[model samples]
Target: MLTNQAIRNVANDLDRRWISDDYFDLIVWYETEVQIHGFQLCYDKPGRERALTWTRERGFLHTAVDSGESKPTANRTPIVVADGTFPAGQVRREFIARSGLLPAEIRELVLARIKDYEDRQSA
Candidate 1:
């Protein structure tokens, strides 16, 4: 569970978070209600890190992280860059396997969001 105030705090929104061995990080947000409004899941920190972001209004976004290491000499800030495709199958499976520690509702919602993304992709 992540408790960092700077990272977790958002105006008029509630959050649930989980972090595992620096490899996987998940944050789900709700707007003062039971319904989830958005979430951001980041994975594969050791390699080419990527994130799957989903918002109720904006939908899903898959992005690769630029760890600011491309130029060792320059101190650059890490940022998210466009990712070509979302590996929906692998990510959904992985999330199911690792999200056992999260609350059942939160986990289920995340899975449902992933499924929604997959359905959109296949359409």
Candidate 2:
């Protein structure tokens, strides 16, 4: 299970730009770790798809420009990179399978745990 603090920490790291282009690959790395640890986390499929589309589109354009197949356009908007998109649906499915919990159930559990953790920390 992923705690709220853990998620916040990752977000903060991202805000600091600690994760670079290679951060996309870290999704697989974290998923693997979760599998080995027998933990489950909630994932939004639609959100994942959006991320995939974003990363793929940007990566394709980047490669085209680098190989001289395409030229950069000053009028083109900069590509927006999202958090995790690697392995797409597979990551979410594997996580749910390994955790033996439905996505909604996992989300509820995580939320409850986060509340508990926050309460304790505050006290």
lDDT tens digits, residue span 1-123, model 2 = 321222233542222111112112112112232321112222332233223211212321111111222455534542334343234345444433443332453334433433443444457
CA shift at 46, candidate 2, in angstroms? 21
Quote model 1's TM-score. 0.78
TM-scores, each model vs. reference: 0.78, 0.21
Model 1 alpha-carbon drift over 4 Å, by segment = 1-18, 71-75
Cα error of candidate 1 at position 71, Å:
4.7
**Which numbered prediction scores highest in TM-score against the true structure?**
1
Any idea what lDDT model 2 has? 0.29
lDDT of 1 by residue, 1-123 (tens): 322223645566566544454566777777656877788888777777899998889988989988887676988888999998778898787787777767788788888988988898899
- RMSD per model, one decimal: 3.2, 15.0
lDDT of 1 at 29: 75
The parts of candidate 2 lying over 4 Å away from their true place are 1-102
